[model samples]
Target: MLVPNDHVDQTGSQASAVRDADAVVRRCRERCDQTVAANEVTEAHWVARITAIAKDEDKSAFAEVFRHFAPRVKAFLIKSGADESLAEECMQDVMATLWQKAHMYDAARASVATWIFTIARNRKIDLIRKNARPEPEDLPWGPEEQPDQADVLALQQDSARLTDAIRQLPEKQRRLIERAYFGDLTHSEIAAETGLPLGTIKSRIRLALERLRHSMS
Candidate 1:
């Protein structure tokens, strides 16, 4: 028996709807695949650029990387609560570190963008800490004018007392204090040099300073 005309039209409409849905799904898959391939190529290109700098100290490659990443890093820092000047400064340092530490990058581990942004983040943290507690002023050794003999003797005696107090500190605290005050290293630099945590370095130095103050008083 032949199907009714309306039933035939209904079946045809259902099939058409299914076909339309399949076509839409196929187009979406195609676009997504194309996008993934494009992204992979872009990532590979950046990796190669970084590798070129690492292997050959390639200035041109570095310049290209700097151009692409500098503005992006600055904008990222700004978004992360850095002011314009601080962001600009941190961006410069991040790019410089990227060039300096390109050999440390592992493409297998992270993308070039990831590696660079990580550096930017660390630098920002370091800068924030550095600014939060400005370095202590240097000991007043030389005055603008020639000091009287009595004044010179008093200064020398004060210097001697400070030296004795620093010598009395615990070895770990003493070393950190010397590096931070005498060697003119920032806490981050000390952390990098000594492979110690930043918090530990700060704590030791603070305790050392407190002891010195008590001794001097």
Candidate 2:
């Protein structure tokens, strides 16, 4: 079958266009697959890296976690009203706790980021508590009688229980308690920083304290 030359040329051009389209489709599929794989790898990579640090005390693995999280945790503390030095100190404390307590992590409960940030938030709370506590030198020991052993023990137990109760509160309630008792923020200041209503802030703090008291009792 003798075909026209122009017809042959047109057929060849159409064949070329089809091949080009197939190539484009293949490239798009490959990219989509890569993206899916990358997404799947991300969480596992963080978990494995953290597990490596926990099992082997691998400095290299810890270095990677620190590289990714420390600056972020520090910035979070600063945003939460800590001074620069306090923020840096809290960051260091958070990383130290992670190193020491990595064995306690449950991957089923939280992602690596959530776990680390929670520790960072708690460390900030501890820093606020430490700064607010009166130093030994500042305590008025006027005629400090040797306390009864039973009284001292009861007081210590109550203090420990209160601390645990505070820790068990929901994060929002805990933050309000921390700001009210530990930080210098007024209710209005916390309201402004949190974008919550002032009444809500007061209500949460009041409710949190009531819970703590009930728990301690």
Candidate 3:
């Protein structure tokens, strides 16, 4: 949601149309007040600009994309039950993918915001799986690697704050979230485990995530 709602990362637009879209978007501000209009904050405008910037290989533009969406993405991860350290790691991976695959975004297929969000959502799910339940068998997976010196220090500091924050979540939320993210389960899985309705499980998870995100911040 933080990225510009433009299709800058998309392709296949005619040259004139692209130029016009860029020009009109830049004039999105209220010239009278020299400020962006409230309505201009819609997702489409940001998508185009971000897509364009990404394709241009402009470092600042890419950095801007990171600055805009990183926090929200991280918050989503943490709310979904990833510890802060894991959320940060997931965020780094997600952004790296965005930069590497920006050209994969096609406006005709999906709006930029939705596409990026899907990436973040998938990455968050993966992070949760990595930390959640044990594997079925002692599979061929490798042993856990030692943390980097800097990473070790950061984890020690960050995990404390994150754990405390999670402990403060409502009991209903804390339990369901633990199952969903930390247990690598989904809403349906939680519902089946608890004998709750599908809707109730989803609502509880959604509310829990939102509350935890706010409380943590």
Residues 1-217, candidate 2: write the lDDT tens digits.
1122232223443344334433443443443443333332344455556766766798888998899889988877876888999888888989999999776554433457667877876676666577543323321112322222222222222233344455667898778765664445776766544333334324433444444345446
- Which candidate order results from sorting by lDDT in descending order? 1, 2, 3
- Compute each candidate's TM-score over C-alphas: 0.46, 0.45, 0.45
Q: Report the number of clashing residue pairs per model.
A: 0, 0, 19
Q: Write the per-residue lDDT of candidate 3 for residues 1-217, one digit (tens) a residue.
A: 2124243443454233445444544543233121222223333444445555645766777777788788977876777677889889888898888888776554333334455777787676555467643423321112222112222222222222334445666788668765564446755676544333334324433453444345446
Local accuracy of candidate 1 as per-residue lDDT tens digits, 1-217: 1122232223443344334433443443443443433343355456557756876798988998898899999887876777899889889989999989887664433457767867876786677676533333432212222112222222222233334455566798767754453325665666544332334334433454444345446
* Candidate 1 Cα lDDT to native: 0.56
> Of the candidates shown, which would achieve the greatest TM-score relative to the real structure?
1
**Location of the lowest summed lDDT over 10 successive residues in candidate 1:** 145-154
Best by lDDT: 1
Worst 10 residues of 2 by lDDT: 138-147
Candidate that beats the other on lDDT, 1 or 3, i.e. the better one: 1
